[model samples]
Target: MELVFVPTPGMGHLLSAVEVSKLIIQRDRRISILILIIKVPMTSSILDSFVESQSRDNPYPTRLTFITLPPLSNCPDPSSFSFFQTLITLQKPLVKQAVTDRISKVGSPALAGFILDMFCTNIMEVADEFMVPSYIFFTSGASLLNFIFLFQKLEDDEGVDTVTKFNDPEIEFDVPGFVNQVNGKVVPVVFLEKEGGSSMIIDHARRFKKSNGIIVNTFTELESVGVEALFDQVSKNIIPAVYPVGPILELESKTRGGSQDESQDKILQWLDDQPSSSVVFLCFGSMGCFDADQVKEIANGLEKSGHRFLWSLRKPPPEGKVGMPTEHETFVDVLPDGFLERTAERGKMIGWAPQVSILSHQAVGGFVSHCGWNSTLESIWFGVPMATWPLYAEQQLNAFELVKELGLAVEIRMDYRRDWKTKKANFTVTAEEIENGVKKLMSLDEETKKKVREMSEKGKKALEEGGSSHMWLGRFIEDVFTNVASN
Candidate 1:
């Protein structure tokens, strides 16, 4: 059977979709996968990197295909915009129709089903027209799905002021099905904004409500209540199916089994030499960037914390673009005095680290992360506690859930939101906050550590035989191939 997978343009989203596609192919060699990447000439490097990464001693079947669409109206214009903007803006009519036409022309009666990223909801119309079963794949955490549903309900009922309640510290809304009260400001900017952003999200949410099934990058055990809550809240007519098939890191590891790449080797080597549970790994998600001051503050904070850490300090890409930073060398040179030498015996800093391998390392005990949903889930899967420093997008919400709700993380406060003026006026976090957060996470007491270890063990087991994630993936394949495919 042949299947088409459509992913949004961001690296995180692309990686999630790619890993899922790889897992599907791994389970069934007879199934062919085609990945439709929204073509952007200037940003092809990002796409190329993903392709190259997939080539290093991986078992993903050779039948994977990448089809690029021509620049068309209604397609996101990628000429000069940030990654997220490019993704949401690409709602061109011509491109949408072209994508529809291309899927229809797949030429095989054996075309079974489609797996589509949530942002590409525009594809659902085509799915309906073609009468093919399609699954809505959420590339984010279940909390995000919950937030989307809540935002939509609020907008429909209460109007603009209700949305603004998100930023009010005193106002907390009881999220249905879950006991936690959420701060309004933590909602993603996309859903709250008034301009082009809101429309895109609304469009996607509408499509999501229409899709035949829902697949998320999460395990059922991790958010069983939230998932069940979401299903309950959606309209009964369109609540097709929900599956939490994840801890996608395991799939990545399985796909990259026996990899011998130099980058991977270097990470292993670094971990091998470190004392067990003595190293901290720091990384922000793909799009997270700190301005020059924030970066220096981080370096100083890490130094002051006096911890043995490995930081993946990726430079900010050319101001607005997602490619390599133009002054990469100069950027490295601006580190605080003796930043390298002072931590010479204790820490290692690199541009990019093999994040999965590093996270899975025995020596690595805690992660200081931007709390992207994927990163958060990976930390849970590996049983590592976190020093949460959510920087952008849904990261704050992810951090809140992990730290406040799950007791798996320590929150580090910083002005992470986009309002520069507000950030300037109220950003109270400093090097001290970073130091304290790291110290707290790294110094989990024996009892706390034991609890963390227990959760981690449970998490790992879920990816193994008969675990929730494993069983869910099995059921998903059966449903998609047998039920959806037969239809």
Candidate 2:
């Protein structure tokens, strides 16, 4: 069986696709894998680097192929295009033509199925035409997907104006499988908007309804309630098929090659030299860019807390520059005066660090995260607690799940302007709030530390052989593949 995995552009989406593809190859000896990506003009270089790295470290019997869809400069956002429409509408044929040509050469034996990103909905038509099954791969948590699925039902039942109550401060609605009634001002934000508040979500939800099956990057054990609730929602047959084969870090770690970059090696060495559970690592993700004021506030907050810390400061390039800050001096002016001198003995700052290795190290105690799903899962896997400061997208919702629902992290304050400003105007977290959150997590007192340690053990147990995630992954392979392929 040959499975062609198609992911939307972006590091997180592509990484999730790569991680799952790695696992699928491991589970089946006879199956072959190909990764299909849409190469946005200048951005194709990133995928080129990724393909080169993977080919050098092919851990599967199946060879990997990198095929590009023709450039679609006319699409509103070329990176966000779906399957058939984007390919069919383009002036010159790219994805469709290339795929059709490849199918002819590889023959039916090598044309088993397509594993597509959820946003790549148009692929279903092509899969049907080719007589191949296409599974939808959701790169976020199952809870998020469940919310998306439910949002469609709410919209259908309530109509577009279904809830004039949306803008209201608090609204309570009973979702099928959750234990508690969901409440929030932006509760329907998951399905209501696209591009984190645009009209794209409605279209994506529509696409989801037509998918063959859903694959999420989360395991069942970590969120039994949410996972079970998801199953319940789909049980009535209103939903497409779903599978939870995750704690995807397990697969990533397994396939991560031994070749480490020089900068990453330096970061690891610095982490190794720190005392166990003594340092806090702060990072706001790859795309998280702070204005000068916000950067100053982070420096002030960290200095006030007086904890040993390591931060990945990603300042946007100087005026007219294309990328991010590449030198240490770039942050000198933005940070507080005498900041390095005062914290010199206790802190080590870097432009970027080997995040996974640092999290796995014994010296790290807590994570200051942007609440991206991948970062959240990594934190949970390493048993390191988080200080959630979500910057964009469903991150705020994910933060709610972590701090309020899961009792796993602390949330910094965010400005909620029900009537005044638009959603883009995010108020910076005050130094006082950051200080308090840090003190709460880094408290040397054994009682608080013990509780966090206990939670970490629970996280570890979940990924083990008989753990919830383990069983769910096993069931996913058996139920999704074995049953269908044999027939």
By lDDT, the best candidate is: 1
- Local accuracy of candidate 1 as per-residue lDDT tens digits, 1-487: 6677878766678788877777777776777777777755545566666655565545654557666655534444433223354554454443456446655774643566677888777666556665778788898867788777666666665664443556565566787545688766566655555555565566567667677678888776677668778667645653567777776753354222233365467767978999999898988765544666776887888888888898777666555453433211324566887788888898887765567788888999899988888888778767888887776667778877777777777778522564311222124357888888788888988776776677777767776888987787777788876665467
Per-model TM-score, in order, reads 0.85, 0.85
Off by over 4 Å in 1: 26-30, 52-63, 70-109, 157-162, 234-238, 250-267, 318-330, 418-428, 481-487
RMSD of each: 4.1, 4.4
Q: Using alpha carbons, what is the TM-score of model 1?
A: 0.85
Worst 10 residues of 2 by lDDT: 414-423
Which stretches of candidate 2 lie above 4 Å from their native place? 41-43, 61-63, 73-93, 106-108, 160-164, 172-198, 250-260, 317-330, 414-424, 444-471, 474-487
Summed backbone clashes in each candidate are 9, 2
- Residue 110 displacement in candidate 1 (angstroms): 2.0
